[model samples]
Target: MTPAPPKNFHTSNPETETAIDRTIPDFPAAQLSDEDKYFTHHKPPSYLPDLEDEVKEFIEYHQRNTHKRIVLVTSGGTTVPLENNTVRFIDNFSAGTRGATSAEYFLENGYAVIFLHREFSLLPYSRHYSHTTNCFLDYMTEVNNKVEINPQFADEMLIVLRKYKQAKESNSLLSIPFTTVNQYLYTLKSVSQIMEIVEKKAIFFLAAAVSDFFLPQSRMPTHKIQSQESGGKLEVNLEPVPKFLSRLVDNWAPSALIVSFKLETDNSILIKKAKNALDRYQHQLVIGNLLQTRKKEVVFVTPSGENSWIKLTDDQISKEVEIESLIIPRVIEIHTQWIENK
Candidate 1:
């Protein structure tokens, strides 16, 4: 279940409480067209080559053999470093539950999954037992120098273990990890380009809580900023991240079906903002969710200008059925239609 909305959460009109966070710097006014400058400022992640290799191998093998649909699921929260060394940073609020769970459903529906998630966040299959309240050790007990699952949790653990093992044996899941927004952007571009080989069969489900503000390399200090500066008060200036969704749609993977997420605190403008994004990015779908009610409800806005909702029933919640179990099948139906139209 999703958490309750924060006490400060409001339902003011758009004019009063805009969905966008103003503290995050707006898109560059002077150099709005300089996409290359953004990439040059934040260097690529160190693991780019290895990540690309894995994605390439996965895509090639699937396209050659099964030729089944492929979905790229980006999850978790991305961080924005304040300094080059990165002692302090800003973080987005996400545990990656939506993305990770969705990946398992995609795989179960016969699609190979490429899961790109924030480091140390929840993972598919293992998420049920790896959360903060529970750990792997909690479900295991060692006796006679042999480790066995605790009897109480054994039934559920065995089921998850079997699914995880099956995915591993079939080589249907490829996991790539990232921590910062810089790494996420580079990895996303690389993955999109690689997945282009699948043509219309590729789907991009971008559920990551990406940061809106970042300290540019040019403005960031080489070392950590000390607390003594300015009487123990620090002032930070950040720049808005470059818009790359358009590039993903028009250049990197033109034929792919892209579904971007729009997370908002206010329900009033949730569908409004989601529709705006579909118009702006020309993507296939936008999944609109509220910060507090995300796991229980979501609004789907498509290019056809229809706004539909998926809500979890009280019975479903009581039965321990996840909302993703409903979201993924609807998405698969949309993807099937997309392929047929192509």
Candidate 2:
């Protein structure tokens, strides 16, 4: 059976913008499912078929004639809706910094990437400037009826633009978007199953901050929930999301090099929880990080006991060197070794 929900669930109204309660209720014995029924009953993201078709074409192209490796990089945070119409929802605090940055490094290392990310989240190449305080518009100016990059930002923009164009022209990056958790899971399964052709050469970088609990569609009200109707207090019962990592490791893409991230606020339990996940899922690697220090440091846990830490120096961080710059190369090295041993 799946575990209980995490302790961070809350209820809020849009107008007041204040959380009334953060107490998550435990599931009644009757509400629990023996197996993960999340994918079974929830209506899929409507865009699943289109995303699958795009990925199918992308994977087919990569499988032929070229020795290029393929990777599925999942990024950003998935939403847990409170209602069928989704007036309110629970969200994670991920901007997809790791996944987006890592995808860029993978592309730099000659890997074709399938970037499956939260809708409107950060992306490779464009990610540098897209979600930052100084966005694309801030770096551009209108010059003689044509929009041109400002002279101050031109040099860096040129490098980014060239890399983006090169990836596009080479057909090296295929981006698919998702908003809700159901969409993420369904699309992940489809993409992983489709990637069976590449076998061990395929890498699954599961970096998305998936929600731990969600109100099932069956239980969610069909319309927007009214605060007045509910006696001015809102209570929600969220079910534990199924452990799909087990399915991904044991069934979905068994031969693939799978690496997952474990984020916790507490320092004491971070490594322990990550090691536990490695033991449970039997995946290739689990990257454990504390919420406060994730960008500066992460520990890699493996079943073979090759546990190690990766950290960025203050100097490196000041130089604008993203940790992912260090991370992806190490992961590539590990993947190479895995393939060789296999």
Best by lDDT: 1
- What TM-score would you give candidate 2 relative to the actual structure? 0.88
Candidate 1: tens digits of C-alpha lDDT, residues 63-158: 878888999999999998888888999999999999999999999999999999999999999888776677668878998899988999889778
Error of 1 at 183 (Å): 0.3
Clash tally for model 1: 0
RMSD of each: 10.9, 9.3
- Cα deviation in Å at residue 327, candidate 1? 0.4
Per-candidate TM-scores read 0.89, 0.88
Worst 10 residues of 2 by lDDT: 1-10
lDDT of each: 0.84, 0.82
- lDDT (Cα, 0-100) at 269 in candidate 2: 90
Judged by TM-score, which candidate is best? 1
lDDT of 1: 0.84
